[model samples]
Target chain A: MNNYALSISFIDNKLLLKFSGELSLYSITTLQKQLNTQNILKIKDIQIDLEEVCFIDTATAIFINNLLIKYEKLDIKVSVNLNSKDIKDTLELVKNQKLHSDKLPSPDKESFLYSVGKYIYIYYISLLSFLNFLGNLFTTKIYYLKSIKNIRFKEIAFEINESGVKALPIISLTSFLIGLVVAYQSSYQLKIYGANIFLVDMLGISILRELAPLITAIVIAGRSGSAFTAQIGAMKITEELDAMRTMGFDPYIFLVMPRILALMLVMPILIFVADMMGVLGGMLVASLDLQITPTLFIDRFNEVVAPKHFFIGILKGPFFAFLIATIGIYRGLMVKNDTQSIGFNTTKSVVESIFAVIICDAIFSIVFTNLGI
Target chain B: MDKVIEVKDVKTVFGTRVVHDGLNLCVNRGEIYGLLGPSGCGKTTLLREIVMLQEFHGGSIKILGDELNGISHSKAQKLRREWGVLFQAGALFSSLTIAQNIALPLVEYSDLSQKMINEIVEFKINLVGLKSADANLYPSQISGGMKKKSGLARALAMDPKLLFLDEPTSGLDPISARDFDSLILKLRDLLGLTIVMVSHDLQSIYDTLDRIAIIDNKKIAFEGTLDEVASAKSEFIQTFFSDLK
Candidate 1:
């Protein structure tokens, strides 16, 4: 189907190129290469004969137009002879496509300074928008306090099941393994100093004060935070949020509140579970590595590790939950009207929430140290 | 005229809910053929089956001399390049600009140079009546009419011999719908394409379709020109085309 019969002849400083038999994109390349070898630069005129050609696609038509435009620029006279109405229509579509005039150049690369300024501008705007989102969230909650019975308890239960309960097994396994590693590593230094009995105090304080809360928050940020962004982003893309607004339902109250409330309520319980599991893992390691029996480990843990350490760690739970949920939903609401935006926002939510969790943890650490807790 | 598509005794069943039973139709070369049916009559399903997007339970459908049922993978891929299907939503890739979307098939299937590919993309954009300035815009930035035209341009990118359109004018305004109708007729005349469209837009059917097959009660009740369908005794034809007289 691509066999274009080509016959080129040069006479009296004029080039005559005849083409027929189904010229299309597949044949245009070969035709252009063949025409390039001919010394048409010295010619005064060129004539493209398509009288016998029955069909021509848009690509071939554009190729022919490009040839004509090139010759016109070279001050050489050009004429295109065509027969079929189909070919005539194709040529008419591409008749005005000049090479340099119609062709779009690749976009210029942005300068480094320009990109830096652009990112700063974007972050500043996002910061303001986030403050605005926080204000709206508080006002919505305050307004809904009068009709607290109208809140969706069923949706909150569902969120708790999905984000909190479903996360139990993984969090338990991770924190348990982390506690075992920390206790085992500390056993070596204790044994060297002949202070192996102190393993209980170290494991209890570290797991209760740092590892359990921090690790639990990170895992939830990875799991449920990303889910919130993807769920809300998809809803935004499908216009479900708009549909809810049109139905006189606020998406913030209907969609965002249940998730936030459920996470805030369940965060402390999950953290408490993580703390127990991490201590159990450390106790197992202490018994195996240092010959500290469970009873002895429990006695020393109770004597030295005060309840304030656990309470302090649990105190950070709701704050971390608020950060993760708010950042996730904010990124989700920022999603544009395309599928790609969902993925972009989901990634952003995971990263930003994890970062916020660590920063919040650090601030808590600093405040407790100054207060001598 | 040579037959470009032939669907013989095709049957489609979704878990015993029979959609099409013993459906038969033939589309000739260089004509705009329409599949007209009420909602849930499986016109889109039939179009999908013909394009190999969906499989039929029984019977054979052939296009461009290749049988669709149980076709080889390599042969199916080859046949796929022989036609272009414009989905209902224009289905332009959200990640790419309009020009890149139109140039995708050519870039994937052909060895054309970048310069030639760009020129061909421009030609197609102009062919579908889109402005050259709109080439760099994403699909979300364009209006409904522009999106449909961009989709038509992408469908025509490979210069296929056959074109399948699913409700091309369903979401367009009246002026845009008529413009799309004339554009279809013009493209058919210019490219000699054998088009198979599933549409219920009566105005589009009257304006562009050379022949139509109406499906009712799981079978083709009428298959002929508009004038021929006017006299058919089918209830759907009577009710749907009654105002045409």
Candidate 2:
């Protein structure tokens, strides 16, 4: 199955090329090597033998067909000796395929302009659908004011537990480690000049105003965002979403709204917890490595970091939550009716949400900097 | 004279409901057999049980003279090679093209060359009255009738001795349903296959089935030739056949 070996036999001016084993992609290297050793010009005539070939995939069939065509071009009277009708029919089919399919979008005709246009059109369609989804979501939320019971509070509570409560362990762990690394690296230079107290200033502002919320958003995007897409994508595949719609239930309210609302409500709380853990990690590093006491670090932290800095960080939570939840829910609901689409959409949900969160963070930084927060 | 399928005292339960109990049926070789029942009457469950896709709670079911409930895995696989099933909605693999879907059985079970596989693929597709060009299209690209036809072609890939059809004429239009029934009759005549199909289409049942079995209240209410079923003296049979009016 792995190797397609070929041997050439010369008998009385007429050369016989014997094909042994499978002539497939895995064995293409050896097949090409064996096929090249024969001098078709000097032999005057050749017989292509297939008596020993055990099997051939599509790639091997195309290879053998092309080799036969090359021999035919050399004016060397070459005859095919396929012992089985099966092989002969396969060669015919592959030959037809090459002739018919080759005429489609040949590189000679369409390349640069065609690809650029195709991608632009695809992106335009996706962008339009995304805007449309946002419009529908806004309308649905507005209607929630008249009928509050339609919001599915139980499902929202469940999602809060899943996306918010369940993610605490990993989020806190990563944030703690990130805090320790930043503190250690910064204190490495700070301790040289006995500026250990400034480590408190640097770690306090960075962990609260930047690292904690950003890191928490990313972890939740990976964990809960992908989970939301996969869960809804599976429901879409098995026709559960359709069944719900038929039974007088809105998927946006019952499925998407709960997930979005849960993430929005719990994101600030999770980020707050992560901020505490991260500061604790930095404080632990300061006390052990730089000889800064627990009381001194806290006293320094309180003097430099204002309440507005912490508020600015948590303020980005609902925005980040909206971006992640919307993208994930949109990708899931819009997935095509195939299992491959589930994986494809899930990956997209995670990647796009992460990218959007970073951009949102940068914009928040610029706005907050200008406002002097 | 040859019995292809025998079901005796078979029991099927779904939660609190007993779908089938002590249901007995015998199908002969090379005959078109139809299973008729109302909605939620366990016709599909019985088909699944016979095909060994689902297990029964009790009793014996024999297919091709082998006890389906007691057969070993290897033996079941060997038996499976001799029969083909066309599920409801075709259940054609969505990813693969029609030709590849039909060629799957031969490619896995036989050592035939690619040329032979292609030939068999084209032949079965033609046997089911599909155009040669239809072979390259995926399941989603085709219409519902085409999907059912391609499903039929896939079922007949290995020249199975028995063919099972689950709601073969359900989703098709009236004209397409009639054509499909004719195609089934043609294939059965050509291949000499014993066909057991579950259908609610009266036209299809009357047109294709040589014999009919009616299941009611967890048992076979009647089992006989189509003509015998039409004339059977029973309350269920009277109401069931009266629907033909």
Candidate 3:
């Protein structure tokens, strides 16, 4: 509620201000602004009468104290006429606050150029640290290669279940929808030219060579990549990673390798599943929309869709897996001493992995086009 | 002479584990009351029950004349604003600066202008022994002690008649804990607050709490001032209070 009343007047070179009602932070601003627009400097004396004020909070109390100080600094006579001990005690609280406190140091503000320089510096440091992490991962993998028995097979199996097998439902749903929509849309044009049977050729080639692998990789990047970041980041925050290091366990070998190996091992299988589901969807749309029988669709698919296209799609899986796992684990290790940074790094991991997958796909397109695959 | 809070035969159960059965306690107005017990003895749980954050299996908790059980939504909200709670880990929102954290309750519940809110926030910051410059830092950016102080400032923002603190001095250094104890005493006398705190710190208990209730075996083992607690026969109570010379 706007529950305060304020009035001001001048009498014999003295500015008299009277306030009433509940004087709290809710109404102090209006009173301050009104007092600000007045010609109080011209008066020789100032009087603030809070006799009718029923309640006053710390904000109003501080305001009254400031008014007394501001006018008194001008060598102007100031008097406060209030009888409430509550108000008096609040003012005294402010007074004690001023006397017994060490002001905390605030952060320094930087110029635009300085901020740019700082950003570049931070980027450089992070790049160096990422290179270090990559080097350590390579060495750890090579060292564990000689003694393959040292690998954490249990953790890798668990991760495969988490990132690969558990992802089948969502992957199937999205891939099937995409394949059906593409077949339906392409059949619209193909039917106009009496090329209804060519729907199988289009769906088989595209889904096997590009759509299945790319879609599956993108989904994994969003799911497993983000989980890797958040899990590791939480471990880092709780000092679990540090505890492992202190106990003579290398985190890269123990934690990072299991995730990387599991994802790489599962990616190709996940893409194969996506290809089957997508083709199943396209086969349904082919029979329903184009009046092509299931046998006819299967015949066209097997005769025209080359094995090289399916192999090419599967070949991209491990590379995409490597990119997603490395980026995810790298971002996780980048987390600082806060829960917020874990969230920040998790978001960065997903975006970077997805972007990298697309870029890697573009590179594959260029290489295949040149080699005439 | 007025009772600010009363827990009558409160029973709390989780599965077959009975945390509190037929436990009772009362807090008088304008007194600093401590809820003390051994670790995992349900001191924090009892405090949570009183603040209405957790529900009890049976019995009623009355705060400022309103029964918590079967209370209406609007009535619960009104009762909520009448007091403030400080959690163990400070519980400041990581997304907001310290100033914004303290200003949140006032902005949400009052018609105070932004400028006035800032003034009140500044006063509260100072009142809790926090510096004005520390206002811009997020909860994660500040020290543990500073975070506790910020939490205390936020708790006092509405000038609540009752304050609930859970282990306010647990993680603080000795100097900061002592400072917190004196701050509690000063704020209690100045604000006339009836505080209910769960504390393991012996120094804080002796320095601030006018009365204490020690929970043992899911019931109130003893309830009185520190002088009266020494005579209690419970082994847990003797172990806890015997260290005090």
Candidate 4:
């Protein structure tokens, strides 16, 4: 039932008593009995090393404090050594609490309202800070561009080509399935009006202007965004960022710039490939269901999905890429010296990048719709 | 005994907590300077400031006679190339092999060919007393002492004039700690490099340091040779030294 365990090591008359386990209310009587049985009162100097101790409660602190006072009266010195700061601070707190035990507790009613108002103020400040960050991004972009040029472009090209090009097959296949589903669904509706051939136009426009970019963004966000966050986050937690700084290397240049630029370059190409695959998927469905010739479908697609649609879709590519890389790097840099912060930032990066991509897509949709493209 | 690093009236504050207040120190060339203090006494913070990893709010730091704050980024990087740091916990890249870790600085900073870089990595590895076969092993595959050695090898890859180590002997057995200390002494003697180490290991400090700086009460509480520090009249220092013994 004893909550505390103490082992004494005698080294040249120095009594080093190693205290371990918990020291709580349940253990105090047993502890006192053990101390008395060990003839602890006979010892001149007792070095109570709490380094190995796991837990110390109020009861333990009071017991230790009383022992110290008792030993003081006996003219025997008592010294305590605690390994952890938290434990030491907690013990100090226990001592202070004992000193002020007679004081009445007063709860402030306005504390809740104060906290709410403080949070609101923080929210506003954060919003303004985000705007400032956006403004800094433009200035940072200039520095980033200059620094990007310093990076081994060949290395970046290899990384991007590996990450982006290798992903093409999966992206193409997924987008193709999306196109096929759209074609099959629209065919059912179009056949009701006896205008089934128009399914080509519907599939073509949707794949080109919306589905391709949206799907591509999501895929890249999951793949590249996560990679960016994990890579930078690992570097950060490991002091590699500090290493870079000490080496006189701008981490933004050595790490972030290449990543951001690589994503920007690769995304547009990936989107283009996705668009082609999606259209081909639509063609497969159209020929199978509508009994339409491939030539007729191509003609309709070329007529319906104009250069404007292609341009707008491709435009979203770089923006989405930028969003993913920026959010990833920003979140990665935001990570503190802890593993939990890294996980939190990585999740934030993925969520923020995806959200930003969707919001950008909405804006593109509204703009293209208004422009009559 | 030329002054390689000088800090005058430096102050660093994170929010309301003053990490360093008016802390001053001067480290000479070719001397092993040890900063011995309890946890959160700003030893690491001071080391960070020396390498320009952390900024100061007041006063100035001069490394090799160049004002730390005034140096341009590229210039600072060049300055950093002259100094090597072995961070606490080794901090080796998980993905990189020992060879790749050692080769990083040479590859990044120098125009050495792959063959030359390989030779340099081998030489550095051997200098740290690790076999060339150990080069391919990742940091996780090695023991803690080996990792520390690998970190030391990586730091020395650039042939830096100054070496900074934070808790270099931490988390090692007595023999390993002693071996690491000997390796540090060997590197310093062989290369004639100045070393600034932050540590609380009394044995290591006494065994290796030419001088010691004691950080306490948000400032440099004491700075002198080990004998002077041991013989000092200060209650805190006396208690600290006695506790270590």
Count of clashing pairs, candidate 2: 0
What TM-score, computed on C-alpha atoms, does each candidate reach? 0.60, 0.51, 0.57, 0.82
Residue-wise C-alpha lDDT for candidate 1, range B111-225, written one tens digit per residue? 9999999999999999999999999999889997898898889888888899989899999999889999999999998998889999878899999999999898999889999
RMSD of each: 22.0, 20.9, 21.5, 9.5
Task: Report how closely model 3 matches the true complex, as a DockQ value.
Answer: 0.02
Give each model's whole-structure lDDT.
0.87, 0.86, 0.88, 0.85
Q: In model 2 chain B, which range of ten residues has the least summed lDDT?
A: B87-96
lDDT of 4 by residue, B93-205 (tens): 77789999889888888899999999999999999889999999998899988888898888899999999999999998998899889989998999999999998787898
Descending-TM-score candidate ranking:
4, 1, 3, 2
Going through the candidates in order, their DockQ values are 0.02, 0.02, 0.02, 0.49
- Chain A TM-score across all models, in listed order: 0.93, 0.74, 0.86, 0.70
Candidate 1 per-residue C-alpha lDDT over A1-373 given as tens digits, one digit per residue, 9 for 90 to 100: 6568788998777799999898988998899889888887788899889999988999988898888888999999998898788888888878844423655798989999999999999999999999999999998888767586757797799999999999999999999999999988999889999899999999899999988999999999999999999988877775445423322246787779999999998999999999999999999988999999999999999999999999998998999999999999999999998999999999999999999999999999999999999
Looking at model 4, residue B53 earns an lDDT score of: 85
lDDT of 4 at B132: 93
TM-score, candidate 1, is 0.60
- Across residues A1-373, which tens digit of lDDT does each residue of candidate 3 receive? 6768989988888888998889998887899899988986678888889889988888888888888888989988988888999887888898788679888889899999999999999999988998999998988888778696768898799999999999999999889998999998999999999999988889999999999999999999999999999988877775446433322246787789999999999999999999999999998988998999999988888899999999999999999999999999999999987999999999999999999999999999999989999
Ranking by lDDT: 3, 1, 2, 4
TM-score-wise, the better of 3 and 4 is 4
Can you tell me the CAPRI class of model 3? incorrect
